[model samples]
Target: MSFPCSDQSIRPRKMQSASLPGVMEAVRCWCGDVCKVKEVTDFSDWLGMKFFMCANYESDPPESISTYVRPPSPPPLCMYYRWIDTEMPDWAVTEIRERGRRAWASLDLEERREKAEAEEKAEQKK
Candidate 1:
């Protein structure tokens, strides 16, 4: 699935991240904010899909978020939405997926550590 782009002027800008060597930098939204990658893990079909959204969508004033869902409302969010898992170039998508996997692994490790600590505390109380 692809998000609607109302503004043709704003295009996706490729960027590079030094910390995430394999993953490419996030694309910039029409509103000039960097796009954020949202991980999809809800369904089997959409699992592992990383979609990009305007980083400013949830701003205090609710700026730049796409209103396309409701036409006749207002200008759609900044023209900066794409599926990195599918739309991105092959090489870039591969790197991005790898990065996502690594992130998930880190999170899993942290959760395990927390669980272990909680178990140890419970045992000490007994």
Candidate 2:
């Protein structure tokens, strides 16, 4: 019943900031340089973070920082990191290793025994 034309020039209003999802920020060591990265939460949960081992480090293990400098205006170091939307502000190399250890520990003697027994039974069935 209203007029056919509304203010066509004006754009629709956006939601208030109160409805925005949380933001994520962290420092990551990629290639050789450390940089900051940003992401948005509420989209997905972060599983874990992992650092990449630079391929160059194998053959040209830099004697010093200068030795690892980017070449001829080369792009920043090629380091890569796996980041997820989660709280891992204190994650370090050692922390990651500890996770691996704990995961292995979770499969202790009892679990191993059960697995072995199951395998033996399956073999008998065959």
Candidate with maximal lDDT? 1
For 8-88, candidate 2 gives per-residue lDDT tens digits of 222112111111123533333444443333222221222232222223322232446574485544443443333232353
Cα lDDT listed for each candidate: 0.57, 0.38
Output the lDDT of residue 62, model 1: 38
Clashing pairs in 2: 30-79, 31-78, 31-79
lDDT of model 2 at position 56: 32
Worst 10-residue lDDT window for candidate 2 reads: 11-20
TM-score of each: 0.37, 0.22
Clash number for candidate 1? 1
Clashes of each: 1, 3
Error of 1 at 121 (Å): 0.3
Per-residue lDDT of model 1, residues 1-126, tens digit only: 455454433332332211212557767777878777765433234444565667755422234656665345444565456656554445555666887899999999999999999999999999
Worst 10 residues of 1 by lDDT: 12-21
Q: Tell me the deviation in Å of residue 126 in model 1.
A: 1.0
